[model samples]
Target: MNKEGLYRDLSTVKQQIGLAKQFLESLNSVKFDRKNVLSWFKKLCGYLTDIILTILEIRSILENHVLNKKTMLLYLYQINTTLSLYINTFVAECEIGEALNEVRIFTTKKLSSCLDGIEDVLIKGISTYPENVGNFILWMDTALEKMSEIDHLKEKEKCLKAFSDAKILFEEVLSHAMSIAQVSMSEDYKIIRGSSQSVLEGLESLSNEISKENPNSAMVKLFAETCSNKLCALERKVNVAVLKICLSTFAKYTDDLENIHKFCFNTENKSKPRDLDNLVMEFDLHVDRIMQIGLFAISCSTNMATCIKIRSCLASLEALESELVPAFNAVLLDYCKQNCNLASILKNHWLNEAVLLKRLICEIIDPLAFCQIVHEENKYLVHTLSLDVKANKSKIDRSVTEQVIRNSIVLDDFLKLITYEEDNIIHIKENISFLQKIIREVKAASDVFLPQEQPELNFKVYKRCKILLNGIYSLCKNFLVENSENSFSKEESLGNEQPVVTGNGFLDHIINRGKQILQDRSILYRSNKIEAFDLRSTTLSKMNALKEKNKSIPLSKLVHLRKISFVQSPTRNQISCELQITDIVNELRNMSLTFEKC
Candidate 1:
């Protein structure tokens, strides 16, 4: 196109766009008075906008061929893409707004003539109808794709995060709507068709994008079959499946338990439990959907079977059962007693059962306190073995690992609160005696595990685990020091009852000492000798002697003695990571050969 022709074409398109925007603005204000007029006006506006935008893009691409054919083509495509998004957004907002308007008018206008149907009709026409939902998903998926291709990494990241959040929010809205519908207005078959179309369209777009980043198209295809396109329509069935997943397995139960505990205990909001119930339902639905897809895969029968087999390896103990039952029952009964109000009859019994399930969850999770649950649940071990079966099943996603830890710690803290006797006034610290012992054992185990090559987390996780454990210890120690002459007599366990580990001044000493060790400024020498079973209080004679000696020690001496108990009793070698083994050996040799003292 020549310059004169191009100018004429651009001006014509601009005029058409201006007219179209005006018509759209009119539709935005559509009322009963102008609804009929604007309805046809909106259709004309859409047609003219599409034609003009397309023509403008074609002209731009033709004019810029020599210098900017590719660049201009991409730019024009983007412009068209954005205009297309605005059209969809405008239509959706306008339609929904109009439906809302009709519902309000009918309800308040006291129109007793078939008015109840209007509210339901509006819902069906604007939101829950399969066609509307399918259209919404299509528009959202395309807009997200265009947004994903933005040049800036930060912008790309923000868009991806927003897109993910929107997917979650949209899914929630879809599920909630499906849940409330008494009878499906549309056939189950139609709903499935709509949901499947939406899923497949979005899935293909996401899959292609994920494939570009992942570079394992064939593996993705294998998993692709497991992401059923009909999931949104199967909400009820999926939720049941999700509940089963949450309640039926070790990993799933512990994960849910932690989440629920946090929901109950760790919220700044008073409505956290309410939010948690919604989350729990959502999670259960997810579990159901995942199971439905994974368990029913036609070709990958073995993978689902393998997941089940892996789950069966949860360690069962006959003896721990005695101790676990009561603690579990106590928490359960308390929760059940709290939630006795009934919503539905079927749910009343089930909610009561959940009231009782408090015990099973508590018992199953209590072993985590003793560090035995790691060996019990052992998802890592299961994944390692799964490698042989599938030869392709990757380890759990990093997000899963993070969620698990965050949840587990929250539960552990909850248990700690329950176990702590905060109001015993004089003897409120029955548990404080065990804190140092636990810390010592954790430190020793960490050291032993540090040099191991088998588990393959040597880079940092051990240190991280050690830090978390130390934080817990510091927390306990501060509790003791803060309440030295006082008690938890005036306090509740919830609502910021105690300070975090770093809140105490004494732990500052330990942290600074660690930093010094890291910088090789000092070696931690053994401060106490390991006796030959004499000081261990093996016999009545030694016990009597120890009691006699304990009564006379100064307060400073007692604190030093207790702290030294964790300094690796009887080990002669200095404990420091940066200390060279060779240097120590050479020093020993030099000491042996040391001659005439000058």
Candidate 2:
């Protein structure tokens, strides 16, 4: 028979066997016939064997070009063997139910094996020829539908597991193919256009499959959507790659301009106007390329993704132009200005302009402009600088104020010990020594403020130093006064306690007047009250008063006080007094003399 006639006769017999099996299953036990059932089963097995033999003949005639011919032959052979086994066992034992059960189990196992075979073929086919993924995916759908017709749950589950594995394999193969296409397109678009077109065709086929109402409809739709999204992303990457090419070309032009900048400033050229003009003209030659790249980028900015890339490229261009043009112009202008200055410096050495210009460009303008550009790049720098400066200033102010206050307290303690009582005298000497040490420390701390270059800070430190010095002078003056007064009081008390040489009234009266004069001196010293004085307030008042009196004393002069001296000598009576009183008067007289010398 011809191929078409044989195929039609085989299909008719297979359909008749399926109808007979269904009719047998619909029968009750009361109506069952072992002879009729066995006849139908034999006929079904014979039809399957004929179909397999016919397919093998067609394979030989057609050179095995049909899809899965070997797998179809293997499944048909196994099913036919199971049917023949059931018929042999039934004829020998006359057990219809047992024979039918054995055949059913065998058939289910063969169907499951068939499903595995189809999955294996799909995996191998798609991987070996990814370009034909469309055909393998269709085969998988048909195989799964056929497996679902089995009555056994275990067999059906096995078929479904194989299908799921096949689906994963297909997705992996398609993704790999897409990656290869993407890479090929990046290298040469024209060469890969055919491959990309084939991928598009495959996707179209998958889309058509998704539109159908089938068992795996959701899975197909999910895969199609994933591929579509990937394609869209790949298209964006293409646009970005084009924009990058334009950016690279524009960068080349900027680099050329930078090179020209270097050539013009090369020291061997001697800053000649002719050489600089030639270099600048060469730099201008790239202007056409820059404009072309800019135009291309602008033209490509039609879509949102490409527009973003184009905007980024444009920003880079703007930065380059802004930086390069200004730098070029500034260098030229500064060279001209400095060259004129160099001419005035050495009228005969015009060639030295090259060295001077190079120094100006390298050492001064370039570094300064770079710093300014960096500072302006981020607006946060100015705000952060202001905050840092304010914080540092406040911290320094607090430290300085606290130091001044501590020094003032020390000076106050030193001044309070001016009274020459024995305890006060000892403390007075210790405080003087302590004050000297503190003055050295304060001076060292104030030296830090001097280098600050702030006039207000220097003046503040100066005022604090002046206050400390005046306190020292005031303490010395009060100590001297109190010493002199104590001396005079001791002399008077000694005179009063002397024996009354009552024979001469005038001598007695003179002694009494002398005592009165000493008392008045003590009263005058007490009224001065310099020990309890506020030296800073006193000095400030004196300054204000001096200003009011039109006598502006210099700080140097104000820090020094006039020393008090005594002209009076101890009389014979004072000398004849107790030795301790005489020694006290003598010490005071020496101290006063020392002050006079100073």
Candidate 3:
């Protein structure tokens, strides 16, 4: 025999036999010894058969290519490695049902002598181009060296994908289980758990690898795997939780089938099929993966260590699924029994049957009433405070003074309202005093209105005031700040912005014309009396152009033309409010005079 040539030929034969041996071995370990094991084994074998088909196809290509000496050596290596990969791939491919299993049966049987246990399992080979065989081999060697780092990550990817597949299977089992009895369901449940555990262990181990430095993309993959694991687990948990919530919280008793109907029949929305369809599809996928993969194996178990690890994973998954049942069911029941989130329930109700929810209309009405009361009170407070500030100003920019005061008052009020705890009785008081502080500064600012004050109004006062008002309005509209829809604006009506009111003396005119005059004297109003003491002057609404390109920005930032702060003086609102105050004041004065005459 030619020493070198013979050795090479033998090597080729050795490789071919080695690959075939692995598949046969995995086939033998197909759990056929156990009752359900054969089912799993058969499913796995289906994938293996396809894998073998793919291999034979790829192998045929080797005949067509002419190989040089170096190419031949590499090509021979490629053949065996490629074959091994086909087998391993049963657990490797995504979405598709490829990536055959890692057969560790033979290895498992000889765990005592690991080195000699099965060199076949110990070796990992891949087909490479003749030129790149050196590089491929080197890469694999290096990979093995760093295997400890990526091993977890590799396992995780495998595990996650497997779990995903198993989940699909579980759905089928769960459907059948539901139709059957509890004791019967228990056996199938174990199978689902075992499949899921195999998937999770693979993912978790990978996640732990490079979770620290984010090294190589292993961490990202690890994270993705972890998320997938978490998500899949949560998906199962969600179904369990939702069922529990439905039966107990929204429905009836422990033994009552009516409980299920409570969730199905009395839905908030009218479309039962729409809601159920969505839930069913989502849940169906979740469990199907488990059942489908539970009884399937990619290839035979040729490696003892791999088999041991895999079995351990399968056991863990089964344990989690089977053992956690009571707890999960209890959790759902508990959620339904006590922890009813009104918001969540309402949302679900709406989803279940929106039209039906209309029946509960009055339950949402009182909150609206309270909201209206708050809005009216705010309007009275805002106008009053702004007016008082203007009255107090000395010789400042009148417009500046009014605006500054209004803005300050509004901003303060918002800060108070939003931050105010219902338990805390504090708020930016909507009184004259808060406005008064703004009035003084605004008056001073008004004297300087042109370049400085005008800019100030644009930058500081007007802009700020606009924000505060808009914020309050929006908050109130959302029923976050004030309350009911009709409280601020009429619903089903195209609500209009408060119109711009032009002209001066509007304030003083109203005050003086009041039936009950606090004082009939048209006293000096402003510093030089140039500005009138009328509500109309300062209260006029303006249609300032919003200089914004992006309309989505808050209305406060875009529009600041006008405001209706109710910070008016006693005689400021004319026929509206001031007149009423005046009439009362006059009556009081006349009474005092009568006392004097007496």
The lDDT of each candidate is 0.31, 0.34, 0.30
The parts of candidate 3 lying over 4 Å away from their true place are 1-436, 449-458, 467-494, 497-598
| Candidate number with greatest TM-score | 1
Estimate, for each residue in 435-529, the C-alpha lDDT of model 2 and write its tens digit.
56655655664667656746556555545554444434434433443433322111121101111122334333323432332222111002212
Q: After TM-score superposition, what is the CA distance of residue 358 in candidate 2 from its true location, in Å?
A: 92
Arranged by lDDT with the best first, the candidates are 2, 1, 3
Q: Model 1 over residues 1-598: C-alpha lDDT tens digits?
A: 6877755665555455455545444443545333453354346435444533445344443332321222222222222322322233233335444322322221122211112222222222211111111122222232233223222223435535533433443343233223222112223323422343344355446445543543343433333332322232233222222222332232343454345444443335343445655655644433333222222211111122122221111111111112222322223344432121111111222223333333323322222222222222223333443343243322323333343344334334434443332454334243333434443443454354434533443323333434444444334333344434322221111111111122423323323422332222100111113222231122224224434755331121111001121223334222221132223233333322331110
Q: What TM-score would each prediction reach against the true structure?
A: 0.19, 0.16, 0.14
In candidate 1, stretches whose alpha carbon ends up further than 4 angstroms from where it belongs are 32-50, 53-381, 384-598
By summed lDDT, the worst window of 10 consecutive residues in model 3 runs over 555-564
Pairs that clash in candidate 1: 242-284, 242-288, 328-359
